[model samples]
Target: MEIRDLTPAERRVWRAFPRGRRVDFTDRPPGPERTVRAKVLRALLLTQGAADGEVASLRMTAARITGRLDLKYATVEHPVSLHGCHFDEVPFLYGARVRQFNLQGSHLPGLDAATIHVDGVLRVTGCRVTGLARLGGARISGALFCDGAEFGSPGVATALELNHVSVGRDLYGVGLAAHGTVRLNGAEVTGKVNLRDAVLDAPGGTALNAKLLTVGSNVSLDELQAQGEVRLHGARIPGQLGLTGARLSEPGGTALDVGAVVIGSGADLTGLQAEGRIELHDATVTGPLDLSRARLTAPGGVVLDATSLTVGSNVVLHRLQAEGRVELRGATISGQLNCAGARFTNPGETALRASSCTIGELWLREDSLIEGAVNLRRSQIDMVHAEPGAWPDVVKLDGFVYTALNPRRPARERLPLLERDDDGYVPFAYEQLAASYRRIGDEAGVRAVQLARQRRHRGTLPWYARIWGYLQEVTVGYGFKPLRAAAWLVALLAAGTAAFGLHHPPPLKPDETPGFNALFYTLDLLLPIIDFGQEKAFKPQGGYQWLSYALILAGWVLATTIITGITRALSRQ
Candidate 1:
């Protein structure tokens, strides 16, 4: 190469000769360092173009440069390694197609470009990139690793759209996009994506939109915060989605809409707080959906409308607090659906109306009080061919108390309190109706349902319950007439004693001794006996007074016999 007039500032670091030489920089201060670094970079770009397909590796080992390196539209047909360079201004590597671009521990920024495709592998590990980085529409052929990269912008209004990109291996963006909006729409990653500890701060709107994204392996978003919505609408994941301790919030609608998604493994979204709805309808998960301690609060209607989702194992939502209806209408889970302590306080129609949801043993809490209707109308419990284990019929509402202003009359007037369709007649509803009909003296209705249940099945109701149903019918409508008959018999005996005498013979004349007239004559002689029986006991004063006591015993015996017969007839009727 010929030596040209490159000024004294640039000539301090002359370019290497045509046949591979080295430069000495022992006694140089860092004054004209930027001028030297720019000249060296320009020469390297020219050499890289000249080699083309000949050069296999261009390893710059241990270089410290401080300048604005511009490699715009230069084709580096070999792997370029800038291991330990520190730049002052932003480096422009726009539209450079290289085999492998390694910039480990490089301090650079302002990488805002379009279609800067890295073919083999782009590793920017341990780089401190300052301004907003944009790689929109770039086709990354291999794994894109930016592990330990520090991006220090206030992370607002930053647009980093990586749409239509395809990474062969893992797209490791760990600590990358620590404060920016990462738009990875329609991208395909073949390996695990680790975005752990990423502080995704997009103030204008969504922090990340991986909608229509397809991942081949696990995606870890542990402790990640997309302050706005995370729009992953139709993403297909071939592994477990680890979103533990993530804050995916939106103001209006949904923060995360995993609708129509096919997750190969489970989704770990424990402690996720979404201010808007989380729609997971028609999504099929191959493993359990762990949503423990997730507070999904939607203001308008439902917080999580996962109506037709198919989870392979348990869909755990333990301690989840949703303000609206948590609608799980047609969801099918293969394991125990543990929604224990989940609170949904929507008072319109139903708080949790799982009408057609098919699942395994539902481990919901007994103390979980739903404020509105609990509509499990056609939901299959213990369905053998539906989900997995036996479907649950018994739901626990421990310590549940409702004080709403419901109408006193039932929805159906012909039915009892437990038989109305609007009322929640769980297990106790039929039980109470069987008891209330027996109480209100409706014996026919009480025996009718029991006999219907008995004739309908071989052994439907218990024997004692049927007996009590019969006896309860009789007791409420039975009359009391035994005491009334005893009063009538005593009145009849008083009338007979006033007309006929006790000691007078029927064949004799009025001259009979000890007749009623004689007795009355003797009583008139001894009015003292009548006054003595009132205050003193067994003091007859004469043998004739004994007839008064015998007549009184006979009258009481006849009254008691008539009362006993009347009571038996009344009870039989």
Candidate 2:
């Protein structure tokens, strides 16, 4: 910090700036105007070693500069530092070449650093800018810090705009309190963008408009409180985008709109609380997304709409208490989508609509309470780790193809999940469940699911269709229990044989038939498809003919039910 001796004109301007005591004070006392003009100011600075220029770097305290510090389109080679200063008018440093821009603890009306390139850090720590701090197209070779700074006044306008700016190192803005929006659109940062403990408010507008921002490392907005929306649409972050303990409050509008944003690492949005909807439509994350303990509310409407979103790793939503609907349609997760210990409440309407989604595995087992229906139609998951009693009542599993289902209950209790709703209990649902059983080598469970499907299928049919399914299920277990029908047939055969043996039917043609064996006669009438020739030759008279007619009808019913059972068994195999 080798501050050169000031000239008569430079010393006059230095006296106007706040002294060492004023640096700690919050308020600035009035001072005289600057006496050094642009020509004299440039000549005194810009020292080229020792011989070319005799002046040292311009390191001054309390630099209350007047007039527009217009260094635009100029080359400032010397290191300039002016701390604890107050500006009469905003500086115009666009397209200027400065070694460094350290204006910490300064009070400026505005800043227009567009296209200005700084070799060293651009620090404005603890400064209070009353107007816009525009840095569009400005390139900084080192870090850009605004820690403990306040930007913008009270209104719905852009407080800190960094559009198209390129920073070589980190951009730290911790404890930054922006009254209006903070736009970082089209900005590029090689290091992390840490905005931890920042407060950005814009009433009913965007709070942090970070569209198209390309960051090489993480973008942490931890413990941030935004009164309006936080838009990250079209940003490309190569590392994690953490929003741990953040709160976004925007009533009807979207709170966090992150559509089409690409994050190379996971988004750790743990403990995030949003009043409005959080939309992540079409976003691509290459790592795990943990939303554990987050409370996203949009009661009676969609809370989190993540349609077509792609996650490379798992999405952990453990203990997340969400209200309203969560639509994850067409999402593709390479890892598990765990929602254990989570609660989703949206009565009647869909609580979780994950239709056409694909996941490596699903965990919705213990302590998971979803009040509304869960529609996972056409979704494909490798396995489902669920508890039968803890799962939602109405789960739409039509076309939900999963390889395995591990439930903490017996097959009897778990099979009822497929039969709870007739509308969702389609043929594909049964086949999908059967496939899951087959994966675990549970042959009995597979047939049990198929039987339960028939039961549900019977309930959804017309009276005649119901009767047909009922007969098949009761007699043969809808081809699942073929031996059951065999046992019933044997009982009927013995009963019919004894009835005709004691009181034999008088034969119509005595010479056409031999000795009437009652057992053979009963067998002939018991089978509708096969005739043993005993029924055609014999003729029963009076009440005996009624017994013969009843047996013929029973044979037809038994034959059709048996054929149905065989067809179903073959189709399932």
Candidate 3:
């Protein structure tokens, strides 16, 4: 359009475009004087105007732009800055290439910048859009700023879509308020994606869907308040994915889903408050996963499901409060799994299910509270640092193996933990406890645990087998206390000697009999294998004969039990 056809606002913008001067119409009233035709603005951006030595840009503020800024498939050389401007319709810039696109504080119905390429930053800071802001498949050489921007109203399907978009620098959405889903699925950001203090409300639907998103640096969602599910499933972040102080609520459903994601620097979810389940299944984190002081509540369901999650470093869950089950089953942690001051509460079910987990060290300190059971079945942990009080009423330790135990308490204190296994009489649990004691050279603890194991095994045996087990325990303490066998032998010998000494027996044959001494006679009768010929030579009649018979039977009983107990003990060693 010519200068004669341009409105007063457009005339000012037209005259200022060559010199890159900003036309401020904030003082103008709402009339034709403050209105600029979109075609005039687009014409100035597309045409080359000669200037002295200044860069040409279409910069205008507080102007009402009428008609669509149709720049589809067009390449504009100059930059565009329309701050605090109001658009009559959505600007159609599909597949267009521009230097820099700045619409900061602009009020638009929506934006259609799909497949567009911007050489410099795209600033939409503090803008309000009542419809969808579609920027899918766009490529920005610089950062994409959307700080304090409001997108769509309530009940919208999608407020802002950046699917498959690529940003060379950071994507800032600090304090951004989106009423529907803000999708960044398959987007690639060379720098960080900062959505700190942002509020996303899409009740009963997804709030942020960033599946398969790849970020070169950190993705900060700290202090973000999301009403629906925030899915980052399959997203790959080279730096930390921080959600500290974030509040996510999606009751009876998933609040945060980061399944199968690969995080290079790990995740920081400290001080997070999530009402529904937070899934991290099959995720891999290179650095530490710090969830300290996070509160996750999903009663009767899983609050945090991190099954098969692999962390290169520590998983710090200190002071974490979880109302439902926290599943770490099949997880592999290279460093310590610290639950120092965490509280897990799931009344009738497993509060923490860590079955099949491979952990370097598991720290369950005295301050940790588990109201329900803890299932550690089939887990292989290098070391465990747990206080006696940290164990819950029921613990499933069958097939659980640990190389070392901290505080190295006596078996009396530690044995109770093994006994509390929900599956009654698990021999492996007792054996593992004994092995832990043996590694620390606690011989007494080993004996105690072994003896407890035998006792527990006795209860599961048949009635006749239990009887024999009881006899072994009473006489030799299941071979753990060898001195008890000797004591019984000495007591039986004294009684046999006294009974025969008081009543001398008659000889079977006078010529064949040797001189009968009380001690030798008793020894000959009580010892089964060794014979001193006193039993063949002597004939003890009536009550005295019965005394000799009783001595013989007692000897066989003691001899059989001692040999069996010794063999069992040797096999264990």
- What TM-score does each of the candidates earn? 0.62, 0.91, 0.97
Model 2 misplaced stretches (Cα beyond 4 Å): 1-9, 12-43, 46-55, 422-425, 529-532
Tens-digit per-residue lDDT, 390-491, candidate 2: 667787877888887876355687777776542754788777877777777787888888788778778879999998887777777877887987887898
Per-residue C-alpha lDDT of model 3 across residues 1-573, encoded as one tens digit per residue: 688987767778988999999999999999898998888877888875749998889888999999999999899889899999999999999999999999999999999999999999999999999899999999999999999999989878999999999999999999999999999999999999999999999988999999999999999999999999999999999999999999999999999999999999889999999999999999999999999999999999999999999999999999999999999999999999999999999999999999999999999988899999999999999999998888999999989999999977878998888788899999999888888888878888999998999999999999999998898888888778878878987887898788878888999999878998888888888789988888888889998888889888877777777787788677767
Candidate 1, 1-573: lDDT as tens digits: 224655453443333322223333334454553334654665655563323234335444344465666777767665666665566677676776767778777766656545677788887787777775666666678898878776646744554557777788888877665466677888888887788867677654777788888888888888777767677778889898888888776767677778888888789999887777788888899998998888888764888888888998888878877777778888788786776676666765466756676766565454444555555555554421211111122332211222111122222332332232353334433433334455545555554444333332322357876554343232222112234444543454454344334433232232432323433433332233243222122223344355445545444443344444456445534
* Ranking 1 against 2 by TM-score, winner: 2
* Residue-pair clashes, model 2: 2
Q: Which candidate do you rate higher for TM-score, 2 or 3? A: 3
Q: What TM-score would candidate 1 get against the native?
A: 0.62
Which residue pairs show collisions in model 3?
A: none
Backbone clashes (count) for model 1? 5
Please identify model 1 stretches exceeding 4 Å from their true place: 1-31, 34-42, 48-73, 83-95, 105-109, 128-132, 150-156, 347-349, 367-372, 383-573
lDDT of 1 at 36: 46
Question: Clashing residue pairs, candidate 2?
Answer: 17-62, 18-62
lDDT of 1: 0.60
